[model samples]
Target: MDTPPRVPGLGTFLDKNTGTPKPPTPQLVTVASRLLLLAAVVQVVASVIAVVYAASPARLDAIQLQIDAMTGSTPSLAMMRNLGILTVVISGIATITAYVLFALFLAKGRSWARVAAGVLALLTVMQLLGITLPEGLTTVAQIVLGAVAVGLCYLPGPNHFFATVKAARS
Candidate 1:
């Protein structure tokens, strides 16, 4: 039996039937992936801060007032606290999960991941724009990191990598 050809730097074997080699991850993709990971870390830290704030008695009282105003009935304190914690935790997990997944796929030269990362970065910018100024430094860092990651994804090296993969598959 013949040994399959290995793709250098990718640690992946060429396709058995078509013999197309997997493209090595471009430097741009590597940098973008690291940026995405950094963004995720920032999000996690923000989430922790949010959770701590939500756990505070003053914030809980504010949430209770809003709930009472909306429903005309006061929810139990425990229920309100649980809801706040759940919301922060779930949203944080989702945001981090998305960033990590995008980074992983983009590093693999997946074309769809590049599109997804672009759309996410655009949406994040739009959301930031809608918010008032004087946002936390963490928010600013997130925007900058996200922008850099999206920019790297569109750089020539990553673009060429995606094109090579698409051509090979075709």
Candidate 2:
């Protein structure tokens, strides 16, 4: 029988005789891609929701009243509403970038993608601790949800989920 191809840097990861670096198994890539796609979908939905709220004056006033009551802030409702909307927009951009990079990493095996994912995971934890923990009950629920998001990304489905993509690429 004929021999398989060889990958230059992989040594014998896939029989040394095989000439192409074995592409990341399709199943793993698909899992990672889907995670990223799901994140993108959630972010887009949230952005749409924010846009709806931003456009509705009555909705904005109601939200502002609640916030003002809670924080004892005397600022006008319009200012508070603008701040909230701006936060949503900024978060949307960051979310889109994260999902896009994650999908790209799964497909192309970029090292930076691995680093970025790890950093994002850590940020998720920090945000939970820094912003959520102090707020109690509702914040606790948000922290749990954030933890799940980070946890899912590192699970076994995403081939070498926590490993160095550069090494795999090589």
lDDT of 1: 0.78
TM-score for every candidate vs. truth? Answer: 0.79, 0.51
Model 2 stretches with alpha carbons more than 4 Å out: 1-24, 55-59, 62-76, 111-115, 118-165, 168-170
For residues 86-148, write the lDDT of model 1, one tens digit per residue. 999998899889899988877877777777877777766665554534435556777788788
Kindly report which residue pairs in candidate 1 clash with one another. none
Model 1 lDDT at residue 113: 73
On residues 97-146, what C-alpha lDDT tens digit does candidate 2 reach at each position? 78676666545544345456556545544544544232333334333433
Residue 116 accuracy (lDDT) in model 2: 62
Determine which window of 10 residues in candidate 1 has minimal summed lDDT.
Answer: 9-18
Global lDDT scores for all candidate models: 0.78, 0.56
lDDT of 1 at 53: 79
